[model samples]
Target: MFYLAFFYPVYLGIFPNTFLNNHIIVIGIYGPLALFTTIIVFGVGFPILRSAYISLRDHRLTVDVLISLSAIVTYGYSITSLAFLGRQFLFFDVATTIIVIAIVSNQIRAKYKRRAVRELTGRLRNAETTVYRLTDEGETETIAAEECEEGDLFLVRPGEHIPLDGTIVDGQGTVNEALITGEARPQRKRPGDDVIGGSVAIDGAFEIQVGENATSTLDQLRDLVWNLQADQTNAERLTNRVISAYTVFVCGLAVVTFAAWLALGETGDSAFLTALTVLIIACPVSLSLVTPLAIGRGLSTAADRGIPILDQTVLERITDADTIVFDKTGTLTTGEMHVADVETSEAADEVLQRAAAVESRSSHPIAAAIRAHVTEPTQSTDFERHRYGVTATIDRETTAVGSPALLDELEWDCPPSIEESILHIRERGDLPTVVGWNGEATGVIALSDTPRKRWEDVVESLSAENRRIVMITGDDPRVAQQFEDHPAIDEVFADISPEGKEEIIQDLKKKGTVAMVGDGTNDAPALTAADLGVAMVSGSDFTVTVADALVTTDDLLPFVDLFEIARKTRRRLVENLTLAFLTPIIGLPLAAIGAVTPIVAAILMSAGTILVLANSYRPIMSQDSA
Candidate 1:
């Protein structure tokens, strides 16, 4: 539309009509002029008038007052200019050019903003599984979240989204609700248990009767995120208010410029042209757009890498986090246990066979590891179940491996050597399991696991950047100490329960930014209390929802990259803001002095916008390549 509108006149200018009396040419002249005039009137007058009306309605108009007065004065001079009407070619062309520039810049700004919105929204919308509703007639139907309605009954299988916030009407299961609570631990939800939408069921099945419609559930969350982002921050709000006030000042200046020319008896054309240049050059579009554009692109780049940044405030907080807190079990180390060592008194093969046989009935990772270690044939027995750990008769001796209290209750006697080994393993911060004969110690096994691969490097890198790393865990102090002595660690806390973690985060908040990284129920409070909270992607839905940031990949290295990305983003934002703020300061005086022609001001404005956009892309493209 813009291209056609702009080129038709050029075509006419170059090809002077061959037929003076031709009906087509006569109609085209009237049609084009009318269309152009209507567009200018609506585009220029409506916005200025509407803005004035809104300002009046709201009882505030420092900027709108200026714009309204400028538009009225310019329009009046434009109408009365004898030369402007006599030389319609130059007059219409100039006016059209200014209007076109304003319209086109606005369109470009909208396009970029939408592009940013699309990128971030896509990351937030990644859902792995869907809930299927079973109708009353015993038929299963899969429905998108938007199609779900209140009071609808939905069935969530072992691996499925909860679909909406509701209570379990008749079934029970353990749900990974990290999205809501930031708790990595799977919560066992029975009948009447409240479930939130987007939470995954890690284990067990649930039949949830939906209470809230999809719009009220997921859509509401999406809206909350959008509103939080759209609502300007303190700095942005102040900047906009100042910009608005500046715009009003410019309008007043335009009025003064026009009145001064009029008093000097200058032609209406000259006065109008000067005032128009002032108004166009003074538009705050570039200044108003600086922060949003830079931050928007930064978020888009991060989202492209599959990192879900739930809260935008985390970006700044994370970059400045001097002290990093990590929960030992799931945040740093792999939550899964592994078989580290095995020991026994009898032949190694016989001891392995006995241990595997006894452990086959257990679901613990250690038990699974023992079962994987040995291959042998043994008589299957219905292990006599006890209140403590399960018991079984092996040959003539009963054996069991469980809590120390369980073993003590069974009155199982073990050798001093085995007892000493257990103490040794515990002192070294290894999780240990014991195996013994009916009344005598026979063997003991030890397992040790630490932070994820490259985790130490991540900590070292942060420290190299002058960040202090701290390890916080619910495990015994011995376990926490194991990581504290690690070269990267600056502090350590052990046996710190959920409440303790929250308290530590609160204490840290008194000084500066605090970030808690974890993946369990115990970590939820700390995650919420900290300045910024990060959780593993695989953690419970409750945990993820409460967490400000989430590291989806198992590798911790990406988080380091995230910190770099954030810092780079902040740098770009600063650059954009500086450019935006400086352009008008430099250009407005030139426009007033008539040193900057209207065309020149428009060109400068466009150049400023392009520079702002180009600057926003710099950090993103660099990080992508790096």
Candidate 2:
């Protein structure tokens, strides 16, 4: 019906003597049909006009303003020419095509965003595991996983997922923690073993006690990813600003083109048509889409690989960073501390027992290592925790276990032999804690942590192209000696206090852009101080909250993946932006000179939008294939 009504005038021009060309036939049939078609098209395209009005009211301009102005000009001119001139010089098709194309382009962008969001939030929506809660009568009662609170006891049978982050209190089992740590091997779980919420128990049954903070790690990660997905990046903001200014310039140029053509003795209709063509050709649709489409793909790709970017701007910052600072403990090492050896003047077992008793009530990693080393736990009283260590009364005697500095603070006598042993332990890159009592230093316990698997490859990948790699830790300087000679490591700062870590990051920023990767609470200050802060999955909650990016695995290889993704995403943005500008640069001149018609300009605008969409999907498609 629309096509018949639109081409009725052409039909009449070709067959002037036909019965359909009569005055009454033209008024009752073609005129009303054409008017109805125009009304329908305008109604369907109301959103574009509304958006243009809102932007104008706010004292700003956008691509919508240009598209709306072009459509309105064509429609108004066609109506006036029909009413006053008694000639149907209609360009309603141009107006309808432009509005339809704009609507389609917006739908394409919305669909792309929806797909990306679905990919990120799918795991969260599917988390509905059932938990078996232990009742006060020692009977198990089934409950929804989210309903379980902290301090609640639950039973996890074989082949079942752990309902929440908690400690195993009764049973031993083998748990596959791949979902949390990215380690494929099954980890053995016994009493006091910490288990993540998403991990599955491979064998044996276990009664678990929820941690004080029983919120599921998976849930927290999902919420974080979801919240960050909507954040706009710096590149996106810059592009928006460019588009706004470009829209204003295009609108002004269209007006100038109209006046110049009329001044050159062209008719009003011809001059107005040229101005409308200019508006159609210079629409900034592609420019507005360049950064957001690329960023959406980049973030979705990162989330799929267990790396959630908490800030979309981190991608830009990470690519710009010249220096990468790593925290020693959980960032590069497994962070599972174990007592490798014990040295003492007195019996070794007796010293271990006394140290364990003193550290029993502390929740520090070193305390857990000491407690785990001694099988038969001894009781202690009058427990006191110092800044550097802990002291407790065991068997009516005060036993202290911590750094050598703790003994010096207490004015305890440190025998030369004990001091020499501590020095040797530090030289071997092992953590040394002094176990002293009776107003004298008795022994030193050397605890060791293994470097994370594939750490060397991660470091080498990140240290490419003269980029500097630095490691900082609170341990003794000698403990960091192991990394001092690493070819990829450019510097090592050891025995640095938490405040000192922040100072180091600030100082490094002066030399170049710095990115700090860490996992512990002490690293929180530094994480906040760096240009880009990345936190491991095992990091303290505070560190994760402050960091810009969170790697949802114990492995450091995500750092490599993240940097590569950022670089590729940035490159894609450049490619898309360049393609976006090329259309207007080449078409505007032809449009202003009356060589390009409104219909052809609309086609070119749509083609530009399609080109940007395809270019933005290149990295995402390649990532999927890989």
Candidate 3:
């Protein structure tokens, strides 16, 4: 349709006589075909191409408007030429219009594809990993993540993207799984614990026996993120509607103009030329460009900040978002267990030794922390493994301690002093786990993960901007309220199941758009349900795959940056839409009175299109600007 519109003038120039003589009869005879052609090309083909092009580019550009304008120009020329001619002219004009439209749309698609390739290449380069390998001198060596393979042992230093999925074979340390699960806590990893790829080792050194190769791990994650980002809802329907309506309206107006001219006693060529001019000038191609250019620029700016915007349409949704729901464990607090309190009947050193011995066999996070804090004692053949826990005789007593469930069968009772200590530890805001010997309580250890440093500030900033911050977590309510002193949080729902999170999102959606921020496998459903799901780079693949946006940094500062970028982008889109919506309404009246010639109308419309694009391309300010 765009090509036909642009080629209309050329057709009129070549076959001016035929159009003037036959336009009235032609419309009566071929009205259905012309209208059908317009619907198929402009209504369907243009939108399909435009959407596919935008998806491929991962960015919007100005050329979309040019394609639209060219269509209108062709139609305008065809009609104007016929309005002043006789008969004996036809095919050449239609052919030229078709050629121009096809060429311009093809060019736009090709350029966008090339640019997308470059961007993907750059991200692959920057998102690499480094692993340490054993050297001849019992030292270690560093290599790319992809170079490491299954069953190979590698050492992880603090602040590293775990190159592969693996279990720790030796040593102890705290690993930040925020990138994998969006948990802010640094989890303890001891021997036998499973560590995921792309997680940051926050504090500790570990020798890992690799379980999965880097390609299988992170590539799967990237694919998941891409899939989640591509899901669409209703926001994109507006652009589709505009494209559909514009095409039909332009074609109808052209046919009407042609008939009106012939009824005024104009020659067949003159009427055809006038009608074609209307078609070419009124294609609404420029109008189609307004929304995409705005969205594309916004997405590009977000990418620069390490935030992966999966669904570009979410940029518009952000403007209306009033409430932001956050998944607590990984999203708010760092989701790893830490040693909050220690209790013992033996000397601290001796107690640490015994606890480490038991914990070394457990893969739970609490066990990992305990193992890291204690000094390992080499006691040759000191214990015989019992089915419940482990046992070693101290004097005549069989000293044994393990899980609460296992110990309960022994009917072990805590002495008054030990019982008091356990209560004290639990009162200090930590979960207490009892260690026993024979049939008596030996000690109690308490553990809990702390919140991230920037948590309060992030919440406050969003609240100041009139954004409501709510927490949804599977954690106990008592643990979730530890940060309640921070005034930024408006509500909390603790111990929520995945289904519950989705239900909460549905309820929130009734008020307006809501953004769900989370970092765990359990958070995926809610992430998918919300208007926008923001996955912390430190979160899990499940969460990232379901999230609409990906924040690569663990820092909370980028969340603000992400919101601001979306806000500005939506602003630009609205501006473009306003210009597009108002232009033809004003321009058509002037053109009808002969106040604007076809060439002048073409230039004027193109100017508005250019302004919309140029405005959309406004540069994003530095993160410091936020």
Candidate 4:
């Protein structure tokens, strides 16, 4: 229909004066062909008519109603002229041309949007990851990664990806943690060290005991990217308001213009044609396309860079944050525990034996640090666990190993060396625990957690802005002192619980927006409580669901990239919307008067739409999606 509308006039001009001119031949062949062509063009107008009808039934007007009315007037005028005037006045060609342009432009817009979303969710596609799952018989059975569940053991070989988030139960390996941390260095993993799935074992093969999160972190990341790309943002609400008001303004202006012209003693057909021109000139394609195109591109581009925006509203809220709170463990720190010092009351060997005997029975990180220094097991039995520490029978005597509370519960007294050990640990930013033999303080165990490779850089970048950076931790006073002394960190809280973190976030909310960043089970509550919750992809599954956005890697470098994307997206949105509003506002009065013809009006509408589309697809701040 579009082609016929464009080329039919040229065809008629080339033919002989009387060619195909027989009344019977013209009526039977050309006449019927023209009628068939009309039906196809009318079919193209179906969507416009349907949308117009629905909008009218709801007592509202839309851009579709204006387009449909213009097409109807043209087609009806041409048909009535051909039937009654014994000659044709064809506007079907022009109407068909407009319909074609609208459909094609919308398709192009959708193409760009899908390209963005596909780039974000490309990694989410379910891929078959191989693994060696341990059977009930204690033998390895080859299986897909998804088939292995919590508590299942999987063997990973050199250069193979770790198939699940679990503890290293057997063998030793150097695993490249680049997938989670964005740092390419290989981290050595011994028995009992936690290994993240999707990381490659660089050297020796190792057996991992899977934890409760059975779904591969990469798989969860894919699903999260998909959701973020598809979800509608608050920006859409702003555009929707413009659409509603624009529709009413256009319809009401057309009616008033037609009435004023008729009252001025103009002919009915002249007045009506001018009204039709006004409607055709003011299509709102540009209005609807602005928000989705800009925001969708931002999300997809951000995702490509390993920054996943989980919610549309998060982009808006982040800019409003007055304070940025960071969790200590699994966030600012590496979350891995390392033995720092050992202070013995009597014999260093005796205190270590008791700590290891109880620690060896568990998979906790504190236990791993204690096990690293201890050599001999005391053949302990009847091990008991508590919130403060672990208790068991060691050397046929009851032994307690943990915090000061655990020692107090056992009626053990803190010796002078024990008090000095606590002070030393705090000075160096390491955790200290009291070790007791029977009912006397025997020694102290001090462990330290190191900061991430990019922790300082991230802190420096964030501190460059006027925003306040606070560190919240459930760790000891030593860890709290670490943040307090750091120049980048403004404030620090020590010995906070999961509930305490949430309470702090709630209090911060009263002043202004607060963003909480975390990557552990304890951080989930605080992540949910913040105005804008950002979780590192290395965090727990529960943490992922609660966060507004998630960085795919532990690299703090991408935060600057995230804020840059949001700023650019918002700028583009405003530019497109302003063009959509202004061009139409200037064109409407001209269309209503005799100043503009229908052809010129259609062309202007088409141009406005193209301008908006061009702006929507403009490249973001940086071309490097890397």
The Cα RMSD in angstroms, rounded to one decimal, for candidate 1 relative to the true structure is 8.3
Candidate 4 vs. true structure, TM-score: 0.73
User: lDDT ranking from best to worst?
Assistant: 2, 4, 1, 3
Number of clashes in model 4? 0
Score every model by TM-score.
0.68, 0.75, 0.61, 0.73
Deviation of model 4 at 241, angstroms: 1.6
lDDT of model 1 at residue 529?
Answer: 76
Q: 550, model 4: CA deviation in Å?
A: 1.5
Q: Among these predicted structures, which one has the highest lDDT?
A: 2
Q: At residue 232, give the lDDT of candidate 1.
A: 54
Per-residue alpha-carbon lDDT of model 2 for 491-549, expressed as tens digits?
99987755578899999999999998886333655776799988775422321345677
Which residue window of length 10 is worst by lDDT in model 1? 82-91
Q: Return the lDDT, model 1, position 556.
A: 77
Tens-digit lDDT track for model 3 on 102-171?
4443454333323323333356545545567655454456786678767878766433346678888775
Best-first order by TM-score: 2, 4, 1, 3
List the candidate 2 regions with Cα displacement exceeding 4 Å. Answer: 1-50, 75-93, 111-224, 229-231, 344-368, 371-387, 390-401, 409-411, 436-443, 520-522, 538-543, 620-626
Model 2 root-mean-square deviation: 9.1
**Candidate 1 Cα errors over 4 Å, as ranges:** 1-31, 40-56, 59-126, 129-163, 168-228, 263-269, 339-424, 427-429, 432-450, 520-522, 538-543, 621-626
